[model samples]
Target chain A: MISKKKVIAVGAIALAAVLTVSGCTSRTDSSSGGSTAAAGAGDAKITVAFVPKLQGIPYFEAMNAGGKKAAEELGITWLYQGPTTADAAAQADIVRSYIQQNVSALIVAPNDPDSMAPLLKEAADKGIKVLTADTDAPDSVREVFVNQASVEGIGEALTDQLMTAMGGKGKYAIVSCGETAANLNAWIAVQKAYTASKYPDATLVNVVYAGEDQAAATSMATDLMNANPDLTGLVGECTSSAPGVAQAVKDAGKTGTVFTDGLGTPQSMAPYLKDGSSSASILWDVQNLGYLAAWAGDQLATGKTLAATNDVNADLKGIAYDSSSKVLLLGDPLVITKDNVDTFSY
Target chain B: MTLDERTKPAPQSGRPAGSSTATAKRILPLPVTGQEFVLIGVLIVLWILLGIFTPAFLTPNSIQPLLVSVAPIALIGVGMTFIIITAGIDVSVGGAIMLCAVIVAKTMVSVDIPLIGAVALAIVVGLVLGVVNGVLIAYGRVAAIIITFGTANIFQFLALRVFGSSTVNGIPSTLEVFGRGEAGRTLGVPNSFAIMIVIAAVAWWYLRHASGGRHLFAIGGNANAARLVGIKVQPRLLVAYALTGALVGLGACFILASGTATLDQSVGSGKELQVIAAVVIGGTSILGGRGSVIGTVLGAILVQTVTSGVTQLGWPSQLANLFVGIFIIIAVGTDLLRERARRKA
Candidate 1:
């Protein structure tokens, strides 16, 4: 008979082995090597990794859902993986992990556009079709970018909303999540330039940061509203800032007078929309972005060059790409207002 | 040494009571008390240096950020110091913060729970997570580090599932007041600073004078000895972790209330390292039995000042991290060397 200690040791070793094997298999299934191709000539099995800035965000979740839908329709394997946190290094690690898995393509929304360039270049060197969506790394080695909407268009739209809310003339403020964020800065710059050219009556009083934190956004919004009582409109450049600004307005009892708008989930902005504390909000179909990203990866894996007006025949219609730049624009932004808020679904 | 004999003192009362009392004071010299004085001196010197280097560092606008940034960390560090003093570590405090913040935000938004009620619920969640850590460490005799590390991942995963990577906004008015409201300025000083000062004072008083505090040190110094003396080691250890958890929960209230309830997976990521570094640098022995709340606060300020100063200088933000890593190494290295020297002497 075996000693009790010896028997326990053996059992522990066996359990460890089982756990190790299960973990390895699950990891493999979630990543590349899981994709299988159809028999059709152009139906090459491609594994595309759709990496968002972070996981668990509604925006990115929607984008992933859309990507999954497109992937299913196009018969491509979609690897939806990202760091739980919005750290560039974490994102880079995920990219490197996917590359090691020998993924066919990578669609990334970089947390830091410039910082991720080197890693994207490395992926490109390995023959992976690298693309960016929602956010772009212009200097990166990615072949294409599936921009949701033009930065200029977003800026112009925001400025237009601000001007309209302010009744064409008042000192307004902007609450940005990060000063260094390329997209937010781009929007701010465009809005500034547009204000200079188009809406000269509107003056931007200040642009403060909440450091991409929800509480900080709320506090900063409160500070901004309190500091600029004459401020007719507040535009939040980050998703966290919208509800924060609305809450501030509601608390201050200036809801009808001081209108707010920004990029955020309808679920988050629902109360504000209902109460007329906020005018409108804009965001892209994130799930569709993820879906398209996977579809685009499969197309590239099959060696199909993305052409202008190619109509890749996916659930999302009006798909177009610029071959020279290898950039894909994922249609237009969906604006949700009180009138059509019910129609908009995540 | 026999316990009966160790408890008995030699009956050599030749000297006068006043002289003997003075001699007794001189011999022991309050090791921990002297250490705090040195820490304060160092902090003052650093503050002066910062003021000289960056004129704006002393101003309200520049200093407010530092205070706000350090408040959450300092709040968590207070409980952490107590836990560490008991020879236990809570790597899951960051997770506790996240968990608490998520629960509070969800309760506030989804259930429309009042701010205080939501906050209470968040604290309860924190207590539960902490209790799990305590049970694993105290009852199961599992390594505190290992237990907390596992719990950290579990809490993070749970937070992700609950919040779904989205920030929760529309915090109620009362919470916003707690997070950002300034108590009326007294002599041009912000109320937040006063609050921090008061907390530091209370923590210092408790750690220095309380009997429970003395027991914590005794248990940390030697758990076997503590148990032999019937000191209830396990329960104290459990309470330490539970207190840390509650403090982390309280810290989360301030952190979440000060910001929107957006669950950034990265919100408290890698913060455990920083908190540990601050505790160690504050002259708290990682091996336990000795620490000062005052030292931890100063250490927190030093770390935040360095971070904010580096950012203000417009250096690559990574440089701040590099500096912090180096500071931890040097501080801990000096502490170890000094400790070794003391033992040798």
Candidate 2:
């Protein structure tokens, strides 16, 4: 048995030694781990982190690849972290951790904008730059939003493709991913408005929510076709649902008669396009959108204020910045048909 | 706790001392219990109604996919039935499925192995995970739910670490034989569903005729009494969980085949609840002692039917949960009433 006083003294000495060693290591780590460069006035590598709603999907994975290329070109470190599932609370937790790490800048495509606003505010208050990409948060929540295209642009493009397939007038329904997803809701609202104004003969009959499950979305699409005999078109509001709806249309053996299009990846929509189950899909240059987002994050990190006519990147020419809404436009949506779908792969 | 101190009522009058099968004298007209009969009747009614309302509901294109989706859940429910019968639960199987799926998926992507080898690899991995859970719970003397909940997070971390990226893409057509396409079916029946039926039938047999199976019910009914009679309680408990893990591995293969070429990390999210729901809705008691794998298979079919029926009817898909909740209440509520009546008798 050991004496209690001697044990206490020895334990105290060991604790002191451990603490001194840890304290010295932490000091050196902080000094050398880019904080000094981040704090310096010039010639420092900006570390910008991008958080997606969820990782492992083709879309976000493509975005990360593009962001990595941009980071390499711009001489910055691009850290990617996100939840495995699309849970708003998980996204908020990741954002909070990033805030604690005190990165130079953060580019987030938030799962829930309202819930993430406070965390974004904290990151901003800590002098770390904040920006939104692919999907915008509220105007006040981000420094600048790098939007692929305006909601109206995408909505009109999709509706136009559907109308053309329907011979300019027909009954159609919208199959959306989530009922309350901010980006999906915004695009749906614009698509409905566009259909009402542009094509009076084409009617938007119903809007179904599938909650991002492929099977659920496919079933909903088939049910829509079954319930509405005269239905001639479908607009998939998200990437995953687009292929699902197309598969449903093919399963129902209404390939040529019923046309489908939406915001989708080239790979998912390729077979459908080739088989004439879907006429076309509307999307922007995802690679460019990611590149522009990383460039913006780097710009904000390096203490440069974004204003109109800033000429952010040499490669992406003629890009305009909106000061009031803090949105950077990435230009018009491109249409991928059977002839051109082969060229694009996410 | 003593026999009287257990939370739930002990073995009722209708049940034999060490058996749940209706071999003892009973006043009820049929040997089969009310829950199983009620489930069959409800399922028949639901199917008839769905067919009448939606002409497309009875088609092979729709029914085949529905059955394909039902296969994995029911297969796992067989083992879950065994676990729930012994008054233990394994919530970590979902995470276990994830780890198995990514491992199998990555292996298939990297190396061209035979189908049997792929399946064996998945099952072995699952067995190891299940044995870990069994040893911790049975030997450590911890509560099954609490220990499983902790293991669930740990297993998820392992799966995520294996899934360094977001999704595994460009997977080959090696798993197409078990997929929903033309190759996955034989004689107009999905191979996965057929395999599930075969496994469930074997489980139903073993539970009815095997002494090891009867021992599980004995342990569930009264562990102290069973121990006094010289039954090894701890090893039996371990077998139940290890069996569940093995089934989860096979079921993960079914899931891998069910989807497209891309396998995502959300492969097994919330599956543990699905399996539990199937087991309980099949009239299996969560507290312990009473259940059947046959009822569990039927319960899985019933749950899938509701989901497919709701979608085919053009009704709100979310309304299926409301119907499932009602079914759970009715199934378990009547079982509770029956248990109380038997105790009073």
Candidate 3:
């Protein structure tokens, strides 16, 4: 007699086999295989790929949208791809895959810039143009960097905003996304120095690391608040920390009392803004950064001579390309408040 | 098996003779297993020490969120217990969770589906993924770890495809009942934690009393022998994986509710390892034929408590893993010492 276990097992196996076959048949006909971005083909249109630190977050997604716009305007193939997690090894694999594919140019925001330096150099040696955007790989042999404002400017503005919200004189805490994150460390260093010089009365009580988990961030934020009941401000130093800090403030019923702000996306912070749990979020125009990077990539691909003092394309008029550093600078920070949060969708 | 019995072969093997079966079959109500008691003792000591040191660690505000986080890991531990009991493992649960969570999150975004519908879809998706793992391992007769590893990649690929390059934003709060919000609680206890207890209790009963459940232990003990005794070994193996998949679906909802409205692509990263650790720490033999869902639940609780305690103590978050590694060694070491003592007795 066929046992009960056999029936369920055999039945499940049959069902799975059927699903696999069906999954193969119904696969989407996209240009890129596992990669999300596709090329809009035109004759002599060079394909340039933009690899982000990770996928499926608002920040990089906004960047990809900007790249797509640039690709459409410039008539080039925009390949946007990266690992789903912020893992350096996985990112190296993606870079290797791109190298093997031999795309015209490569733009990347490296998760581990030092480790990716050799791979970036390899791509550049093969006559494939290389550039770093959003987060620079200064050690790598990349052609240029597309920076979104100066690091000092962002840190000073972020600390200034938090200090103003705290009324310039109370204990506060800072929650960063991860300790090993390169960009966050740079910003926090500047923030600490700025705080020391500018807001003498405000004491930075805690600096906690959340490790990219929103749940953990919320817990740490709550713990920080509870441990120091007299704290006046909470600064979330990354996109994931803002909501988590806001949620903690809201959960503790200290919305109006404990002011919160961070570097976060508009969509993630809208609810917090409306509820008064957070006052403002400081971020640069990420889409503009992506656009400038893709434009620079196209310039490199078409064999156009990009001089140190050359005027940027008409579509991107205001951005300046520094010849000495090869850095294309996007403008100042865009502060998102309750009144203007609706203005920015991403 | 008796606490002191070691030389006696497993009763499921049917080679232990009649007297051995009689001795092993002595009625003992489920109050405490050896590993479980040790885990409970350790947890109590840890909690007391944390409370004495931290002062705030004993409060509800500190404890409630910790329990809320534990709910999903323990819930998935139920299925993992079954899988391990059959001498099998499913490392693709993390990938399976991502697939279920993303699909459910996307559905909540596009069409305002009811909570029940959302949950059913998650479970069904998980079951399908489970079936994939089951078929390959059982029918193809491949090692469970290797097969699940391959399927993990496929499931992750499927989940990323569903993500479509952007985070699923503005997820409706249909899953708030399982979240850390006020709505997720009943009598100051999180509903997710309560549900996990109920499920674990049911699983405990089934694993102990049901004939079908005993068949799983037989298969794990010796698949060839199980087949000779008219037990369907392949089917039992398949069921273990499918059950884990179903739990992954429900567990994903707990995960979804536990987070912000924005569901990122890193939803279920590193979860499979956590579940396996809990099961192993619960004293379940990796070689199979012995385990309890109750122990798995307690193991999950113990793990979460250590994490919460460390953070509350104002220590570096990185130090929590060092403690967890030490606990795993201690738990396994104790088990090994006990096994040796039982053999000598």
Candidate 4:
């Protein structure tokens, strides 16, 4: 017969071993199932993942927080995850991983339009609703792009701003982040055409790339300032470039002479706007962009077909879908100057 | 020590002590050979070929930018060589670079610290991080690879927490100039390249002639034997890691100085792999005990050439990475073959 003490010892050892293995397995299982259950709840629950070109940017993080607010209000599950870096391969891996987890819908701001096509196509094939927001993968099979503004609208606005700032006749320059960035390039092309047609007297002097890096943007801005001392106005096409350009102008003490404006956050551009270093900055409500993305995701996930006249019920009422382009355009962008700077939060 | 006596052939008569010493020193004057020589030669040939094919390849304007672009990466590769030589690795270098850069940028921008103070603080952060890794490996008795892999995530999280999601700009112009400004021209040559040459030469001198350097090799060759010889293995290992960390910290500052440190989650992502590839291709044995700093410099140049060349050729950027992957495999394969031959001989 086994002694009672030996039997108790064996029992304790067996219990510890089982608990240890179970603890490991359960940790993995619970983490995996947590999001799944969150996605599966009631009719109120809509799962939407905002896949930015990459993760961990203030702009994207702000947008994700905005999206989260909408999710909380609508009782939806919002998953915000993307590649840590802005590389096509990493983005592709994220797409595959999210698909395996079977997210109800996906909204991506693609890094490379063509490189991400196959993966986006795979998501489409899986009956998962995919939308492109912020940046488009035009060649990809993604449906219903949520545009902050029309490409032509952004182009026309940027050109008009430059023309007015330059008094409709002066040599000016543009600082862009990348040549291949579809949205920025589109705006540049439109501005170029506009400069030729509308303001023939206003010459387009030079265009430089800063690679979406702020330091590079600052350097390029400084270079432009040094290269064209008589340049009247500057347009920065990326968020990071805009603030850097504004700061460079301010530091160079050419604020009044060289009018500056572009896409920038209020927090970054506020000082420049107030100090008259920058004339204006154009931006949309990043938070509202997130809200609309979730609403669109819900519409597609619920078998509701998108139409031009269809009003998708959103936290902010009346989100219209343009069936012609399968695109949902957000409200107009605000041109934040000293007058209106206080009105916007982000 | 007389040159004439040193040059004289050992007499057919049995040689005395002086001749025997000379023979021993001459036997392996160059410790590296075979695959290492071939790898360096190949890289040199490619540089010449690219210069011929690309019109702007040899121009100061084109090449200066390439050198600037490769500087930060080359610095990291230098540190990685030491880690790899010790029969261990640290994949956390990229994250460590990011963390150090963020710390420096934050200190400069928010704390309003002077440039010197910020740089010193960044180096200290890197050194502390290296100590953490060393302690975990030496005392905790964990695998260096596993410890570093985990530490990468920790460093990334720390960076994000401190810097937030916005790119830090408006770095002091003085710092920027150091990274971007052309060093003083000597005979019309760029000063940055000259600085790199100096760094390479010093590293070579230390690795070749220093007693501490020999101890590093001995420990790498066999830890047990090194301990038996009372070499104080753990402290040396710690020092090697700390040195690498300090170098990486300097590299990060250069990168930030090159451009504004964007709160990019991917700031140093995938860079550790490239550094590892460079060290491996430099004829460094992955399992430890042997590496040359000059070979590492060549490796960095080769990697940089491929990246710039492919882009200039208008090929897809993906092809650049693919070529690196291929080169790494071929490099390691050749090293293995050479080792096999040496053992047989």
Interface RMSD, one decimal, each candidate: 8.2, 8.5, 5.5, 10.5
**Candidate 3 Cα misplacement greater than 4 A, ranges:** A1-47, A75-77, A84-104, A299-317, A320-324, B1-30, B336-345
Model 1 chain B weakest 10-residue run by lDDT? B3-12
lDDT of 1 by residue, B119-142 (tens): 688678878888889889899986
Best by TM-score: 3
Please list the residue runs of candidate 2 whose C-alpha ends up more than 4 Å from where it truly belongs after superposition: A1-45, A55-58, A100-102, A139-141, A161-175, A193-207, A215-236, A246-262, A266-281, A301-311, A334-345, B1-31
TM-score of chain A of each: 0.85, 0.85, 0.85, 0.84
The candidate, 2 or 4, that scores higher on DockQ is 2
Q: What is the lDDT of residue A143 in candidate 3?
A: 87
Model 4 is docked with a DockQ of: 0.11
- Tens digits of lDDT, candidate 3, A1-346: 2443564476468557744543343222112443433232224458888888876677898999999898898778888876666767667777777776677889999988999999999999888899999888898899889889888988888888888888888888888987887788898889888888888998887788887777777878877776676878998888888887887787667887899999888888888888888889999878877888888999888887566554555645667678778887786777888899888768
| Model 1 chain A worst lDDT run, 10 consecutive residues | A33-42
Which candidate leads the pack in lDDT?
Answer: 3
Docking class of 4: incorrect
Q: In angstroms, how far off is B137's CA in candidate 3? A: 3.0
Chain A TM-score (model 2): 0.85
Candidate 3 per-residue C-alpha lDDT over B33-152 given as tens digits, one digit per residue, 9 for 90 to 100: 667776788889998998898757778777777788899999999999999888888889989999999999999989979999999999999999988899898999876876887788
Q: What TM-score would each prediction reach against the true structure?
A: 0.70, 0.82, 0.86, 0.67
lDDT of each: 0.70, 0.78, 0.81, 0.70
Each model's DockQ? 0.14, 0.23, 0.23, 0.11
The residue pairs found clashing in candidate 3 are none
Error of 2 at B76 (Å): 1.1
